[model samples]
Target: MTWFREGEELDDEDIVSKVDYTTSKLLIRKASLSDVGTYTCKFESEDGHKVEAEFVLYIYKGPSFHDTTIYHEFLEGADGVVLCMVTGQPAVDVQWLKDKEPIPSTHRSQLTIRSVVRADYGEYVCTAKNKIAESSATFMLHVFEPPEVFISGDQHSVNVGERVAVSCNVTGYPQPDLHWLNKQNGQELDMAGRIHVLDGLLEIKDVIPADGGLYSCMAVSTSGNASRDVSIHTQPGPPHYLTVTPGPTSVLFTLKTFPINGGTPIKSFVLQWRKNAIEKWEETIVAASDVLAITDLRPYTKYTVRMAALNNVGRGQFSIENTVRTEGKREPDSPAISTDQAKVEGNSFSVPLEQSDNGGSPLLHLNVKYKEEAEKSEWHKMQLPSDAKSVNLKDLTFGSDYHLEVEAVNSNGSSIPATFNFTVPEQPVSSRMTKGTVAGIVMLIFLVVFLAVDATCCYRNRCGLLMAVAGKLSRWKDPGLKKVEEGEGTTNGDVTLKAISKPRRSIQQSGVQTISKEAGHLTEVTCDKAPLTKNEKLHPTTDA
Candidate 1:
């Protein structure tokens, strides 16, 4: 077998090839793009048949980068782009590299930075690779920015004839320039002689009323300019014509403030006072007015007072001192007293009193006195604390009238006595007597009802009860009496009589017989002789 390049025969040592004559197969190794061309193949059999064909061969290579290096420039916050174009047969894969490290694969030819910063200024590489070969491109990015400026201090005040210095601060890539200006007149301040400007500081010597206006410190940079204003003030003079007035527990001071504020308005007034001239002074801040009231002071005290005026710069000198005395302690007013009903039990009573109006001073004690109205007894006194509103009186006589007086006392003096009149009520009747009377009446009524019921029972039963009683009485009297038969007889001297039984049944045939009392004789009676019963006859046995 043989190979050709550009229509020239190639030697076996210069190319690698494999051929199989039985299978009619051919294979090539280590092929490159230069091997892309047309080739011819011929085969002949022993039977005298032959075949001939020509075909074109194409070789695929890996990606090739169009540019080896790239450059890009942008501000800190601007966007940046870098191109990594490549060409090769059979599509290749592309990726980005940052600082010699492989980045994520995007299959894109361009690398874009959405917002660039200082951290983004570094080496970047774009790589394209395929199965066979790989290529890369490099780029360097630069980011730049302008300067930023700011001022430091603001609104400072200095006293009159005092030296003052104001400073400013700046920050940026490039250092900024700083200067001082008079904001009121829109004029630049001279930095020579008495006024000097060094670095970021501005110094002013011998401040006066003319220099009390607004002054500004300005900072200039490539980016922009920034400024801050400072307000200066010259102190005013002290207040004058101080007057003091004393109250019960406080003091009032009136003063005349300076008409000209000495280049600055008075912000406030200070009033100083003390209990004694040698003690530390207590101060009270007051508005820009003529009068000041200081409270929470001790009563009945003497104090020394002074005044001063204050502005934005500083406090002025104090005025002349004056002495005044507070009002003295006063006594309490008369106390009003009220009383509840007197509770009287037997010979004891309790009276409750309520008192009000302790005046300005706190009450220390109270005095209670009482006397009997009827007998004009000596007054009894009791002492109690000021907080006590009720008093209990013991061992008092019952059914008696009392006159009570209460007085309140404080540190200063006692008030007018408050008087009240109450009576120790009479002893009430005992409940035992009423209960006994009710019991007696109930017993009497019960006895009467018993008697009436007994009578009713007797009437309902007729005279049987009485008759039985009589029979019993008779039996008691004649215990020998016995029941007689029909033929029974009693023997006497020729006076024989038959005894009868059940006299009530034989009363129809029975007769009553009588013997003459003058003759003193006895008689025998029978049923045949007397046919009428004694109960049937209305007439008496003896002739009337």
Candidate 2:
């Protein structure tokens, strides 16, 4: 026995079959669209007899519409048909409903309208039904005339750097796409950071003079497209490139006019200048000229100049301020020199001079004269370049003072001579030798004074005439015999007293004193001991 579908033998790949001599069973696995057909089973006996049985297997699938929704627009009195194709098994039936309600003649898959009317514009639903399931789709039907777009609002005027918005009202059966375009250049305006478009409104943030033109708001649709132009006017901007050229007693100004003109022709230009911050401005009117000249200005004075353009609206913003100073008079003043900069070297010196003010004139030359102070020699003069500020004098005698004089000469005349006096320094060896001689003399004088003072002190202390006299008296009084005493005591001699000798303390040895002693005994004498007469017996005194 074998099973077949569509004239082809079915095996385990298509259907499973279990067979015996009298009964058979067929099983279908994983049924699909192609499996929904007639299936047959045939049996052949050993005597060549055949018998067959036929079976129809149907697959059921849910119904679904071709599209979820549709959008269509048609003019009045136009014929149109909307299709609602459904895909499913067992032949699904589609019905068209208007506003969720079924239409009387909408039995077929397509809804046909002989003539579209204004009242027929509403939501239409297409529902597909079958035994297994049903699905539906919706569509918006618009029955009206073609799009008629109009922009509302008149011409607009806005200042530069301001914000503006323009509206474009549109009338049509279906909503249309809005776009903003530059009618002058035919370029579409994009929704950028500075410009935006929402619904029918076009907005511009910080509008400039260049943005002033014919702007078109276009409404685009399937039926057609419409556009309208709006005139936009922008006010004039500030003037540019204002410059001033100074003269001796006047000034000339040149500038460019404001290009936009604020939607009006420029009538004139206003020029203003002031001496300084403390002065009021002086204004002048010029008849639409790019250049103007102002005279009778103070010489060598700084002034601030500015200009603005005048139009039908008003005066635009002034150009950036420019500062200029008029030239001074022709005759120059005397050049001032710094006398402290007169420098002297070994046998050379340099005189540096600077002109404090040019005094409306350029220098032609400089004359420098120098002469020795003690000599009867004539002054020597030298000519210097106009730009030279200092003159170097060389080969001069060392240690000799010289007087220098400098005068500046211009086209007008020479200035008063500037005088300076300077002395050249001595040679290095000569200066050092002089200093050494003075130092040596001072040291020798100090040594002589030191020796004299030391000799005087030694004579007064021990080796002078007073000590000689004392020694002679001691010798004559006791020529052969001498008295002796021990410890702290007094001694008497049997002799005439010539000069009494007192023990003296030596400053160099603190409290130690020197005393004369007899030949045979040693004695310690204190400064407070009393004198004894000759021929008296000597006695030793002891500390109690």
lDDT of 2 at 199: 71
lDDT of 2 at 39: 82
- Per-residue lDDT over 165-209 for candidate 2, one digit per residue giving the tens place of the 0 to 100 score: 987887665667778887756878876657667777888789775
Q: What is the C-alpha lDDT of each candidate?
A: 0.66, 0.70
TM-score (C-alpha) between model 1 and the true structure: 0.31
In model 2, the number of clashes is: 0
Spell out the clash pairs found in candidate 2. Answer: none
Residue 143, model 2: lDDT of 86
RMSD of each: 19.5, 22.6
